[model samples]
Target: MNAQTLSVPAAIRARRTVRHYRPDPVPAELLDELLDLATQAPSAWNMQDRSIVVVSSETGRKALSEAAFGQPQPLEAPVVLVFVAETAAWEAANTDISAQATGSGAWNEQFTAMFESRAEFHSLRDRGLIRENAVKNAMIAATYVMLAATSLGLASAPMNGWDPELVKQAIGIADRDDLAITVMVTIGYTDAPPPHPGRRPRERTVHTELYAG
Candidate 1:
């Protein structure tokens, strides 16, 4: 943990969409710890169907910024984490997932067998559904990385606007159709930042038992 680590709530409160950044390089050891914590984000069936490409080189950052429609955040931040959704990862790792689940007693062998064979499970295995779930997993992991960055006395900015095709080509995955670029998060230090924009009212966004319009 960083010496100046903040609590979860404080981190959330302190986080903002920072674009400009100081040129100081983020320590590799700190970045590794941040990723170790980021990847701890939960995934569907613990499939962990996501991969991150850390862009630190000047050329890589320039390419990513171009992919992100010339967004300055990617171009300026010391590091940009490209979150990728590996749609085919789950298909090839089911056996391993089931074995681990059963091994850990999280799922019994018989239940794992039945779960894989059930019609309900089959319904969720379509290509589109699988892709959507994979992207969701990637987004969760990105959020974890962003929050982790803030907690570690670092700044981050999540960039959602980008050309996926361009991103794939930028990151050297143009040939892999099974992988999708879900999101990008820039991590670095900032000198000055504007105030948090603040969130919408809880009553307007959150709802109990049943959602109310």
Candidate 2:
């Protein structure tokens, strides 16, 4: 079908996870608008810990491709966006700490009060409900970005099939372990419509109040 024949609804429904991408370049403004739209995603308690790093340069894309287990899509796509979450951002957003307060001791009590409900938060980095909440929020933000790309006549694929540590290093993240790379999304034009992954019917998946027993 011709471009004009494809309706907005059709485009929305047709967009899919594109693994292979053409070399065609995506306009800088479009990428900016999509990322800007993604920032609107709500975070846990509105902390907005989710941060995005957009890679548009050929050299940067190559580095990301290496980090992503040699996934050609990262290099081929006009844009590769890395979603990162600063674990400490939650605390930093709530209370501004002076330069003097910079250790496990200095902020231990602060975080203790913040994530007291979860047992995992006592020692683990991202194992507690509070950290889980951050992860969920970051995923939601990436979803907004994907859907926005679909709306803007673009195809996108969100992939987590890579080494997080390598990605952090390639992206030049200082504290690699503290900031987690939640997801990676590649966006660009497509030569062919992607194969559909059909969804389940609403009746089977949705419940009115409680689940059927």
Q: Please give the clash total of every predicted structure, in order.
A: 0, 0
Per-residue lDDT value at 65 in model 2: 90
Quote the lDDT for 15 in model 2: 70
Q: Each prediction's Cα lDDT score?
A: 0.87, 0.75
In lDDT terms, how accurate is model 1? 0.87
The best candidate in terms of TM-score: 1
TM-scores of all predicted structures: 0.91, 0.76
Error of 1 at 80 (Å): 0.4
Q: Candidate 2 regions off by >4 Å?
A: 1-12, 93-127
The residue-by-residue lDDT of candidate 2 on 73-178, one tens digit each, is 8988988988887676654434433222334355455654554343343444554555566677789999888877887778899989888778887789946666
lDDT of 1 by residue, 1-213 (tens): 577898899888888889999998999889999999988899977778899999999999999999988889887899999999998775553677778788899997777866566443246675348788889999999998988898898899999999999999989999999999999999999999768778889899999999996
Off by over 4 Å in 1: 114-121
Query: Residue 16, candidate 2: how far off, in angstroms?
Result: 0.7
